[model samples]
Target: MTANDTDTDVLIAGGGLAGATLALALARMVPQLRVTVAETFPLASNAEPSSYQPSYDARSTALAWGSKMIYDQLGLWPALAQHAAPIHHIHVSDRGHFGAARLHAAEYRQDALGYVVDNRWMGLCLVRELLKTQVQWLAPAEVTDMTCHGDNVRVTVTTAGETRELSARCLVVADGGRSDLRERLGFQVRHQPYGQNALIANVTTADSHQFSAYERFTDSGPMALLPHGSPTRASHQSALVWTLSDSELKEVLAMPDADKCTRLQKRFGWRLGRFTRIGECNHYPLALTLVDNPVRPGVALVGNAAHSLHPVAGQGFNLALRGLMTLVEQFRLAGEQGSNPGELAVLQRYQQLHRSDRVQTAGFSDSLIQIFGSPLAPLTAARNAGLMGLDLLPAAKRWFAGNAMGLGGRKARIQRPGFDNSKALNHD
Candidate 1:
């Protein structure tokens, strides 16, 4: 039950996006370190590409600029570029209101405010990067059991009908929002369900999206239009995320695509012109879940295992990448200090580094969701007033844009070609 009882630098559970990327980051940062990832999914292969048809998932993600920076560092952006589209502007409004506040890339002199990417395509691209790294890929493997000792962790995994013991100085859990590992380890998390479900689908619009994103708050919930590329049949397309009350979700899900499109078109109005067709629709329940603490001695939780927020703000992946950045950087510094990368001190450094950013972003997201989702008349007036105030303050607008791009979080500086590393100190 101890790392000294076995071998390896670190053991990562769940080789999804977070686990794979963390391994990739650690390999790049600490080249000599041994990082093994245990994943139940089949190893990604060129023949079996991880492409999700809109007719299957109908869901996509918006990655902030900061997340793009991480992808750029991991050499994933180039591969994702073909399928990803940049959102140059964002329009936010109340459904019953006429004026909508717009945030434009031109105002910030930036190429794009953020990017919209198909989640499956992103996974495929990340898997490709992981393949190029030296990190050990334990695929088709399930963690049957795990235990932690004073300074190390031991894990038992079953792969290909055989059991194997894996020991490491620390364990990283990145399973998902409902992490089985976390539950098995007796970690307590607070989960708040919104009693709403997001109905996702791809819609063909008469007018082009013009690379702009839209978020409209209706009485039911928030509806987002993420600009997408041309449809499969050479038509203007946009990804829809329509959040509805639980009762409404069931009604919408039962309708055929044509009927769903008709209802959506009526509810959404003709802003993007009439939605001619709907590709596929799926429902996802909205919830807020967070672990009390991310770190406990030899254990650490990364990505969704640590926290899951409402998708309205598109901060889930951004927060995960941010955590990865901090952890990898801490490992780098630990190695430089002649210490084991997965030791308690090193792990604590990683935890402390991300605490501030995590708390701030989570609270910010909670406040925004609660304020905007409320039907209180006074709060509604205040919300509009706040938007109007933001419109008047150029500096505030820029800051908001920066935050949406994930730049509001602490950013680690990458040493340049001629920079003096000895003189540089950790900014945070």
Candidate 2:
């Protein structure tokens, strides 16, 4: 076959976290398989990660223990540890509420509850690890079209001022929630808009965060304070992901630094001390988006392409990682059974492995947004009551905590109480 007709075992489109992670997982799990990743952005060091970083978003992700396990298996966590902040506790409260329920890593006998990782740092670390994998990385490339043939799928990519054709037994979409490839493949997405925006920024706390994550719910939405690496020597830093009303968002964005810090100080309370300083603030529209299905013929979707949930709980990446790990396992099983890992049967297996988790997590997140985001008096009271009830039940509390940590269900293996190893690979 000519170069244009040459085929790879698998072709992955959209090289963000999901795509990159999937490629690495497949390379490690499926031996001798040729994999190609087509990414739009030129692979660059984290020194400059897209226009998104210009604001120093100071944003961080709360990675569940499960996500950590996958990273460990991929040998990515060791490299990422330098920039990670472990959360030893989580305090959940409500605005105008008298009491708050707290979850402690000590209760679980784990080293930490979860980890707070800067997106830039983790993304760069993943890219660095990706460079070491056997998977081919195609930069500044775009997938123009894809067609499923009798035994293979043909993918056309536009890159470097030329059109190139590549065939693979299977095609994987690792794009974001709004996957262009998913649309090209005729997958339908269901969208649920919260009609709200989440404002994110890094701030300094007068009091040491002591590596705790705080989730305080208000009538508007949830305000999440995620621990970050130490602040400047003079300041104690933490990442804030706060949801706000439209007017509130506009007001906050327009506020002078001093006024904004004062407002934040009033709401966040003295637990972390006054908000002396705030980093560049950014806002993201909140939504609950999911796909009807994640697989089609030789095509499979991983990460955000499969599901994007409300970030209030911060399990988006953890869920994506779980799906990636399952896909890897399914591919390995397909190979051992003498079946093409990119074939319809293999894709179906991965779908089955993910179907429950996808539906449950998506449903859970949507319900949470609806319940907590609403201003109805009854709903607010009920939600808070439920939270209080959960606090009273040790088993239920552990289950909820496990879910947040991405360690829920039979496939999950919880590590140390405060530590997450869900992203790590279990050799045995």
Candidate 3:
């Protein structure tokens, strides 16, 4: 399996955002490497995948500034820009508290703190980009089992009702938070539940969002709203994510849309004025699921399969993007040294490079929850003071802003994707 005896240089399982993005990166950054993706969902085979038309109910994701830079280097940002809404400012506050923190992109000399994009649109865009790449794809396929042997990992993939075995120098598990492939591959996991669930939806307000994001901390839980644009309509809409207890979630789900909006409005305040109209509500349980050493000799896990984080801080996908690029950089190094991507040393180097980022990103989100989760009078006072302090302390604000934009600690200087013979390090 080690001696140039693999089907591809890299075989990625799961063609979701993580898998697709990783494939695109490898195809662009390391063009000499062979990459294939196995996905359970069927993809549009046409030269042009379906494009996005404005809709009120589509779910969304918040992409940090650093993520945007990475996507720009991949030449996908301009396409995404057409559908994305930039977050020029962020307002963080404690409900009913005197202290609040505001982050203005102009103050930081950045164009945007982050962006909000529709999930379906982004997925289709990724699919379109993948279609233009040399990376191979296996659709309606699943890596049912994986067995690592020698220098390569062999996967049993079921594609179009046919069972086949494929060997790859490196295997990436990007199946998501609940990955059967990861379990089958024996990746040990640590899970922690937050006793809360996130209720996500799109809502219209009385006033324009003006390219702002809001994060509100309440005794019940945390809530966030990011400006969401409608291409076909004029209603001022923002994506809503409300964390609630299990009982609260059930109650809200049973309530009428108007009542649910009332509940959200009560918690989030009159920042954007009234919640005029509410869209479909989708909910997710909050938890932290981290896999121990998500990489092995010939295999590795990326995205939610490796670490599932709380969404309040919007760090999950951004962190995954960082990790994904880090892996590609390691593979670049391996290629230069004439080493296999699946070799233990190569994958381990990737892990080491990404470990600090993973820890700090997780810590940032966890600290927010822990600091604000407690509603005791003393802690509430301290939390308010901390918020005010964060606003006043330039150094602290810069650090927080950098992390929020996915640019904190140990930088990665990305190169334009292609074969790079240049010796400029991607990280600073």
Candidate 4:
């Protein structure tokens, strides 16, 4: 596919976090490339934003230090940081066990290991910043189908009540894990259920979290509490993710808010004091979702559409962000070489470069479940020893911290703000 023959250089099917981030990344790195994003959700324009209103039950995501750097390069960090709570420390422990490991931001020479912000707020900030870019946004729109021609893929888009076609040299499928397009296009997926479900909610404690995040693994299941609420102010709210088996989930799901909070307090302990309140409860089955092959001809997948892992490690979105940037880097190189982004060689190169990170990340999450889900005496003792060693070994702690912070892979080639070509790709 030659650039001049297609209606656009790249057409993204879903304008969720992955697609939106990709559009902005491309707009920054390869400004000359025509990029378009069509999403089912309506894309909001930059009309002076309304007053910030707090949603106690709002869902959130933990952005790794590396992900934050990527966003900083895109000049979106300032806005995001305003509402994001910095995770100054992370405390990992084996509940009712003897081992514990702690990671601090200062020890790692970072202001934060990560930042937590509401999912909706993040989307709003991304959308606002994206509106300032040269990329095109088509929404409340859906990319219903596509057909690949000699040099481009013609996309069928349904917007409002009308249907039309748009052609692009490259098509990126980022709809989601349950993507209709991904299914319709017949991309085979490998789905392995973990026999557990994750119960998520926002909880408040009597005392502030002090910007500390907690990861507690118990015989029952693993749970994580990320510092939430205002970034600039001390807050008592934290987002919770509790893993439970079917029967346990059924029991917990049937409880009232008070009983739910009581049960949560028992599982998490009194690290942040009593669980004063619990927000809306949401649950989803845990699974290892991997596409058999994420790339075909001019098309590729990113985010959950490509790989969705158990969230115990909180690496799912971070991994997707890294992959997104990596693909953008490939597109940048392809542009420099005057090769179409949709070219099979270009797509394969991107996939090859990204596959290791995907595999390693998915493995990390899967291993966590298997290793911790067991109740054998030997396994328990070994895990406790490992956790203790992690605390005692500085180098080992650094390695683990680095991976958790999404700094384990090769850096993407997106240029930072005010940086020139020769100075670009130096983000190591």
lDDT of 4 by residue, 127-191 (tens): 78778888888888999888889868899999998999888988999998888999898989999
lDDT of 1 at 14: 91
Comparing 1 and 4 on lDDT, the stronger one: 4
lDDT of each: 0.76, 0.77, 0.86, 0.85
Candidate 2 local lDDT, residue 89:
81
- In candidate 3, which residue pairs get closer than 3 Å at backbone N, Cα or C atoms, i.e. clash? 413-426
User: How many collisions per candidate?
Assistant: 0, 23, 1, 0
Model 3 clash tally, residue pairs:
1
TM-score between model 2 and native: 0.90
lDDT of 1: 0.76
Model 1, residue 45: C-alpha shift (Å): 3.9
Q: Predicted candidate 4: what Cα RMSD to the true structure?
A: 3.7
Give the TM-score (vs. native) of candidate 4.
Answer: 0.94
lDDT of 1 by residue, 270-296 (tens): 878878888767778888888867787
Candidate 2 lDDT over residue span 1-428, tens digit each: 32235468888898877887888888777857788999999877443323223124556778876677678878788866666788788988877766467888877777667888777677777676677778898898988788877767789999998998888878888878878778877888888788889888898878888888888877667788888884222226788888887889999999998899898877777889878888898887888888877787878888888888888788788888888888888878876787766677778877887777777777666776777667888887887788887789977787777777776633555554556654543421
| lDDT for model 3 | 0.86
lDDT by residue (1-428, candidate 3, tens digit) is 55467788899999998999999999999999999999998886552434457689988889998888889989999888888889888899999899998888877566688898888778888888888889999988999987878778888999888999998888899999999998888889999999999999899999888888999999899999988984223338999889999999999999998998898889988979998899989998999999879998889999999999889889999899989999999999899999999889998988888898898888889889999999789999998998899899987887878788877644532222352313432442
Q: After superposition, how far is residue 122 of candidate 3 from its true place, in Å?
A: 1.4
